[model samples]
Target chain A: MVAAHALTVDDMREVRAAAQGGRFFALFDPNALIAAIARSGDRAAFAELFDHFAPRVKGLLMRGGASAELAEEIAQETLLAVWRKAALFDPTRASASTWIATIARNLRIDIARRETRSRLSQVYEILDEEPPEQPDATLSGAERDARVRAAMTQLSADQYRVVELAFLEGFSHQDVASRLAIPLGTVKSRLRLALSHLRGRLEDLR
Target chain B: MSAVHRPSDETLAAFVAGQLDEGLALVVACHVEADPASRQRLRDLQAVQGALLDAADPVAMASGPRDVRAAGQGSRSPASAPSAPEAGMPQVLRPYGLGPWRSIGIKVAMRRVVVPDAEARVFMLRAGPGIALPHHKHSGLEWATILSGAYEHEYGRYAAGDFDEADSSHVHTPRVDPVEGCTCIVAMTGNVLFQGWLGRLLQPLVRL
Candidate 1:
């Protein structure tokens, strides 16, 4: 089983490096971890997941412009959601990281919508829609995850940066262009090319 | 479904990022429900999100409440309502109450969908075969998903399960398919500004 206590930032880096070094298989098994929580309500499994994911979720929220306090709060909520929804996690659909990241992203969005609802109430209504159904079971979660990582590495620096800003930072095309000191049309074309490339690379899995 | 209209990459990115307003997201959800390809695309986008999260620099947070067992047991049930399948209503939309269909123009009917705490207006529009909507531009973003039948605009043909995203720059008159009438769910962030002499004359009468 993975370690059960909270990990410091340095410890997380070592874990991440190990994951990159192909040592992850021996140290952690996400499917087994989730199964433990699902089958026996194992607090150790929950702790392992929380220790690994909570800090990463907070970092992601902070990158998306959330305050530190807000990020921590959302990260806590995300892990709680993981515990509550452990039974629903199907290893066939998505990897553990992908599944937990989605919960964190959705919770952050919910908080943002609640904050903006009143100010934009006359112009737009917040739609608190449910999450999409289980992903198509075409490719194994590990295979898809590896392919995506490979495809991302193949992208040109500019293309990658545009995607990172747009997806990770939630910046609009215009905003990305302004931030990168590039023309708006260039930003659009680069993003378009990047998406097409990623799609072309990942389409075979379907 | 493969040939059906899809939202642009920018819109898809925004949707995945949770930046889209509720009304637009609803229409996109309906499209996703009907298209497996879109669902796959969503998964790919989500994988990118996962990678970014993994590589993100962690910041130390002061410990607040660390009791997962206590917090996890309190009120974390999925807010799923009983399935109430309705014709032309996507499963994601069954929770909201819809108003009565009112005549908006010739052979066109519309019904408002109540979405709380939303600034964008959500509604459903049904147009008869060969019916042409007035040419107009939008003040902000306008998103629509065809529920049944099809429509042809200046851009391209949009069939059932297709999504159409219109901004202030778009100005076109969409005509329902000649063989079958078309029905679409739409969420608009702002009012539609009618164009031309006839459109100006009828603008005050048309609310959408």
Candidate 2:
């Protein structure tokens, strides 16, 4: 039973090798749990989701520089949001981790809004939540998730770091630049190149 | 109809990454709303973010599962439709109150969009047919989304549903469409310094 996670390049290589030549990866089913909660307001399902994600969400926040208290507050808030906004989840479009992480990221942006004065408040803009239906709707969430994982492994190390900082870490380009010790234009170009590449690869799914 | 112009990919990536501030995000969202292509583009970028999240290291929540579940009491009733604001504003803007339109220049009317805690001041601006906005430059970044009609500047033409952005370094005059005029939702930091002596003399009169 291969767990459905790859935290480093070596792991990603192994995952990709397994994924190549059409092997099966029996992953945990967070989507079904979210769907169950959405359908029946299932407390059991919510508890399971909490057990699985609360810590990971908190960890993600802490990596981006949130305090333990702040990360805990937001993690709790994020899980509670999972309970409240479960109905909005579209299993066909995103995995449970993606949907829940998007929520946590939005809540973090809300914190950023409260502290600093910037243009970031656009949460719950349905455009932020409702993915326009994909060109092809038949793709399973896990299949798409795996395809994305494959694409990540394809990116050059420099390219991948930019994507990771901008997306996973939710760092502003300026923050990414300073953290990577690269020029702002370099950050922008790398991200632009990375996204264009990712988009091109994912477009095959559509 | 779809927009011919959209926010830059870097901006859209930032928008997808949850880095764009509320005002700029709203502007890009309007374009995303109006353009299917942009919407798909954002989805593709977000897919990568989601995959990265799956690999993110776990930082244990201080509280146990049961305690974290207790954060919100009982059921939150479903949200109702927001109060109606001015028509022609994006559906997302319905919750925010729109100030009355006040004329700032010949055939120009502007109104504030009260985005709670938004540091960037935003406004809905209308320019009459064939009218050119005063030549000006910004002290900070400015993002505008055309709601209806069209406008043009040295950069290019932005029609209904289009998004345009300019920063301190950009200085040019923009004109309302010749026949239809234009109304755009704009967000910006700092002030607009109207260019030229005539613009300076009238700056006090044209503060938006």
Model 1 lDDT per residue over A1-206, tens place: 23532443335447777679574633556566677677777777677777777888888788767888989999888888887778877665677887777777767766666664322211111122333344355676566777888899999999988888887545777888889999999999999999889889998655
Per-candidate DockQ values are 0.33, 0.37
lDDT of model 2 at position A157: 98
lDDT of candidate 2? Answer: 0.71
State the C-alpha lDDT per candidate.
0.72, 0.71
Worst 10 residues of 1 chain B by lDDT: B73-82
lDDT per residue as tens, model 2, A30-79: 76666666777777667767877888888777777778898888888788
Tens-place lDDT digits, model 1, residues B81-136:
33465775777676566888877677877777777666577788888999876776
Give candidate 1 misplaced runs (Cα > 4 Å): A1-26, A115-137, B1-3, B72-78, B82-85, B117-119, B190-208
TM-score of chain B of 2: 0.83
Cα lDDT tens digits, model 2, B49-152, are: 67766777888666775543444433433332456645556766755667888776667777777775665666788888998766877687788889998999
Model 2 DockQ reads 0.37
